[model samples]
Target: MCSPFTSLSSPTKAPSLEVVDLWFRYPRSSEWVLRGVSLRLYPGEVALIVGASGSGKTTLLRSITSVGRWIYGGELRGRVLLGGIPLEDLPLDGVRRSIQVVNQNPYTHFIEHLVGRDLLSAAVHLYGKELGRRVFARITTALKLEGLLGRRFFELSGGQLRRVAVAKALLWDPKVLVLDEPLMWLDDEGVADVVEAVRVARSLGKAVLIFEHRFARLLHLADSVYLLRGGILHSVEQDFVKKVQRSLRLSRHPQGGSGGRTTGRPLLLAEDLWFRYDKQGDWILRSLSLEVVEGVATVVYGTNGSGKSTLLKILSGYLKPSRGRLELRSRAVYVPQNVYLFFTEESVAKEFEVACRSRNLGRLCVERGVSYLRALGVDVDLEESPFNLSWGQAVRLAVAVATAASEGPAVLLLDEPFTGLTYLERLQLAESLVKLGNTYVITTSNSENLALVPSARVFKLVEGSLE
Candidate 1:
């Protein structure tokens, strides 16, 4: 066995991206999110930072990218170097010229409504207009984003949005590329596209640093793997990926309902469902039909842009189908992929109280919500703002708020509910859903969803129709 950080001492080579004794915490926070973290990424190499949800992986990226300092106004200590130059010494624009970042939420990366215009504008702003167009064309083609060029940014699927963000980052052609959860929300094809993009970046001698929990897809691309836990960075051999995957495997719960779906009276039914954002746009849900039965979990599996979310939105009454017959017997509450949309109240306690009160469940139900949040590993302060919670914590909190009502069984429409959750957290959620006595329709692009809820009735959404 050899030290994973041995390359840091190599005398002849300088790291393209380097962090030395870095420490950071949010403003007015006593707990340090990152403590003495040190790592070096060399040109032509891919470095991976792995951690569970809320383990400060995003915070680490923020620190490395200087967002934690200037924008976030956090207490920071330690140095981050780009091309052997201290990041503090470099102007913000100078740093941006060398480093490009793709955020975990792809929507935050775009400013324009049209995908093509956003990419072209960003590239032109970074480079000259003439050179930017050429770069945009090359990057878009490489990422297979030609079809998405004319599409509205918000209408793109999560996977498509991620691909566009990657292409946008590549347009900068910076010395270092930083991606946060780049593989998330992607189907097999989209995953391959992003993987290839990272490979190409490495081939072009660009240093790449990826923060991801989905190690299975990107482990092979990593030149070094570091685990971030409890504000500390620990080097782990890439072989540990197998152990990580194994740990993520769920032990079959006696209540688990995946392969053997129990069917009862149909709670919701859709016939010949058709939907699109606009009349001229392509149909997202083309003649799609679905039947969700009472007292059983329904899983809709599809690629990122396969209209799964669209279907969920329709079922939840957030959107109406362009043409279809829909009969929803029970009330449907939707928890979107972006869990932040679920939070309307300022504090966690207030949100819980309002949700419970809406169903006449009283303050007791609010206490139950807090207990439920703790069971899901959130343990958030009731007075704290829900917006401050981590993505995983927010998911747990939102689901708790949605289901804490005592007003009988309702249809739970969860869009990628397991997205940001750890394996244990997901397992807890799946088990909770099984016992909640609610009809649930969970949409996801990951096959692991089937394993998590074996009793779920699975439907494959392909080319806009359920198969």
Candidate 2:
């Protein structure tokens, strides 16, 4: 069944599978992302496609939907049929009614001030008036979003927004659901929630396809696995899923790093820190105090919007604390959330060299940059614009550039470092981070999901205070 994967010019059976030599390239990109890719989807089947940065998993999903209708440059070479009818000939709206795509960035979907406004309003617009309050409640509860229906949109964090988008998509009940990096910001429990959602859809005989970099929680959930690389599809068995964890690891946790010691002095200290966005509102960080001792990796774990990122920002001097004394043992360098900004330069590699030289640590930071970039697989055209690479490549490059700025054991506050990274890239990065002698304070929802890092100590942000 794995060999000689066939395509369909026309599909008529229950397991309607049809795609003939599909090819596509995004308007923003000059290089081809997908090359003659073909695959079949059976009813009630789940497919998990994994790939490194620039591997083209996302393009496959879009080609099926012809999302490039907004652009007129891409060349379409093949036929895509569902139940034996050509998709290209069908009305675009009719095709869309059968397939739904959840974008990688949900911020594009936010328009209203409150969660109910965004979701419920969408339901009314899509289904036409008279969706009873009871029906909406039932739908929200099915997606585990009942508690969030009334919350303000600005109040909802990244993870919360992701779930809200998911709930809204489920209301459509399309024949196929395409999720792009669905588990990026979810905690272990939240991951479980998404898994259950997929399971429910599968049980209803809907075709479920997921695109993710990390497959630790997703490997077993899929009936078939596929790897997207170099514009090709390699149908793989479950064995391919398990090897991903090790294959991507430059070195696993216990074996990672040169075992540097970082406890001589404090890099940053927070004493009775109180912070809030609004002067009249409750403090996001309530009387929180912490220290980043040298040569250690301190992990901060908390539910959505619990001040993990807030505290990291305050300690890094990105956001000044509202009250209480704060001190930095050394200069701090922060990696911001929108990491793509770092890739604007003409020469990606030269940017690192320039940053290191500007710091004038001159040698230590420079050497770290050389080794770290190699470990993170930053081996593209150094002279090209950084935005030319894929999302995962951009994320890893951001990590390399930010870490190269270190000057004498400074504090590094990483806010969700593994945003779009694949398992191998993440493991290699975890190795590089553990080896850094500087103190690290990372804010994450699922710190253990990586399973490849050795977090020194974990902190919990409960209601606003870090305990």
Candidate 3:
């Protein structure tokens, strides 16, 4: 076996985590997802890996952490070393204790319903009661998770959920920290919180490996940067980060061309909206009200845990408001954060077939579905399962499916649809939505998204009401 690419000067000590000639592919798959990929992550340093959608960034991380073969049942070759010891030789629990991973979808790792209970319970079990409490308190404070402890897992905004997941991993005080899209779904403030956490981890001499598209934001702190292309890891300079981000534009259509705002009656109306999980609980939406007219997109912006998702649920008719007067003139389709749950069929073809049949699109449903996906910059095969698509692709697919009918819904509600999309993907999808001429109400934490749909009516959700 040959040594992998090393960008830095000679190391004084052994790497905390090293991948040597790693190759992996899922069972029954002819194509290899990772081809002889190798990299080394040293202690007290941050390594950033950036790649386009479906470029095998997640697969590489899974291989380095041994989740590729151990959990997913894939064919794997080569070695992953943890603390100079072969990863396969170490027990599963030991591997977990030494290296902790926080995935892109933070909700997947959450076991308990309540945030405080989950952290405290795991810490106590792993570090005993006294030490666990002390550690838990420190992590929560560092991540600014004190305000989120009382909330349930489902109640958290996407950014809050990610922070909690990071705290959960930090509670173990692992030697290495792995984050997949750590800055995803975060506003500026949320980004600062995560950056601070990473700074602290590095100061304590921990190895941090980040697999993300937003590497430019963290480039200042990255000791080494790599790009994963064609299933191979190539060393890249820090300036390359800016070049790649600028060159990823995939949009072919103009943006913000929605025939301007319509001067007709509102398609949907809500007044005096009030919502809470239970009567004893605090109100999530306090007498919030909104009016959405046809042919005009509405963008609602808010920080994490500001009740943006809850408001979308209420508007989409998925959650009944505790007390509100809502009137809808047409059908409403809601696409949520976990878009995979929106698909009931086995493959993209099957899912679109069902959608086409419902819309009376006849035998052309499959072909038309594929076209819609392509227009939004998602080009997955019809036979592929929706679950197999990347997070950004899945989100774009969900949006396409939600509006696939011959006559699209009168109102479409999206909850954090642009959470994980690249800059180009966001513009493409936003332009496509405008081209469709369907009324849309989207909730997002990123302010940059507002510029994507300039003609859209913009509002801020704060203090449980639209401001």
Candidate 4:
């Protein structure tokens, strides 16, 4: 079989990027995250790096951009060459002009509150006002971001944020582009838009490197695929997707239905629900009504910016309905899309202890917490800081903490909980949710996640109404 990393023919032009015998570790850390990793990306090619969470994919990207040395406070020993010149020897301004990176967290790139100003600021800073406007106009039209320019950054949905981040990076017209989890937070249509943007970049002879957990959707567009594991990189065949599929298969537990009491009546009810962020603003949800029964899983599905998250917030009592009636039989533990917001404790164990203490389940806290973490397939050290966990691990930890808080029967609301998770991680989460046997209300844009609860009452949210 041909290696995915092998180029069709040696390019006449110099390679856009070259990593030779790279080795790196975080400050004061004895273990190296990347060891002797080497790769070459020529102009007009799209390369993909796939790995499980915490497998150093993000670390490799940071190393290429020299962010590890300056911002992340990491020690590095190796050479990163760009355009036939070593990165350390290149001027800072020259490096910045030649390479543009879009981070995994889009929120970190926002400098202006409004979308148009945020995008314009970067363009103007780089190319000056007159030329920047032309560049912004061209890129926004290409990415179909014209409609979002007038909105506030906070008002944009997850998919919109991802698009804007890509557009911002492309507006600079760098020689190399790096995107971390670019396909995340996007719906099917949004994914197509990003894929097209990548194609356009390659057509312009720019090198592109993407770090993604879900690469099946982008496989056809990638010129090469590399798997990062145990601080090493290896080329893998496209057929490796079969392995990912097998990992995603849901497990059938013998005791799955034994604990669930599905005969109970509805625990939460919504009638004539209507909501909007502002009085004059467009209604996000209108005349939406639903019933959630105990021991039953419920999924709300919609496209990007379709108010799925908004509905979850309303159901969880975080946002008041402008006009509606809502009845809850018990308290709810709501976990937002950004799970980090719910964390207050320094460490995972402490967070679990606090949750147990709040519910007066003192003696059982440690035992229950460890059990929950195991169920979620989280193997991180309990003493490690919660912030230190990767995105996928942190999300699983948040779910475990939320479940622990609901000592008795309660409603568990999770918004986009499967954002950064791998296929196996998601499968583990599904099994854990089934065992919990609580009334679960999950909102997601991914159709794949709907299968997590086969028996879930699925509802589609369209144009402010549920169907």
Error of 1 at 377 (Å): 5.4
* lDDT tens per residue, model 1, 47-105: 98888866788888888778888999998899899889898888988788678898878
CA-lDDT, candidates in order: 0.80, 0.68, 0.78, 0.80
* lDDT string, candidate 3, 246-341, tens digits: 543322122553433457668898899999999999999998888888787888888877898888777878899999898877778888777777
The TM-score, computed over Cα atoms with residue i paired to residue i, of candidate 1 is 0.75
Q: What is the Cα-based TM-score of model 2?
A: 0.76
lDDT for 421 in candidate 1 is 67
TM-scores across all candidates? 0.75, 0.76, 0.71, 0.78
Residues 285-332 of candidate 4 have per-residue lDDT tens digits of 999998888888888877878999899888889999999999988777
* Cand. 2 Cα-lDDT: 0.68
Tell me how candidate 3 scores on lDDT.
0.78
> What C-alpha lDDT does candidate 1 achieve relative to the native structure?
0.80
Q: What's the CA error at residue 61 for candidate 2, in Å?
A: 1.7
**TM-score comparison, 2 vs 3, better candidate:** 2
Q: Which stretches of candidate 1 lie over 4 Å from their true place?
A: 1-12, 24-33, 65-79, 86-94, 105-173, 184-189, 245-266, 269-289, 313-331, 343-389, 401-406, 435-437
For residues 344-397, write the lDDT of model 2, one tens digit per residue: 457766767778777775667756775776776667766767767766566666
Model 3, backbone clash pairs (residues 3+ apart or across chains), number: 0
Query: lDDT score, residue 436, model 1?
Result: 52
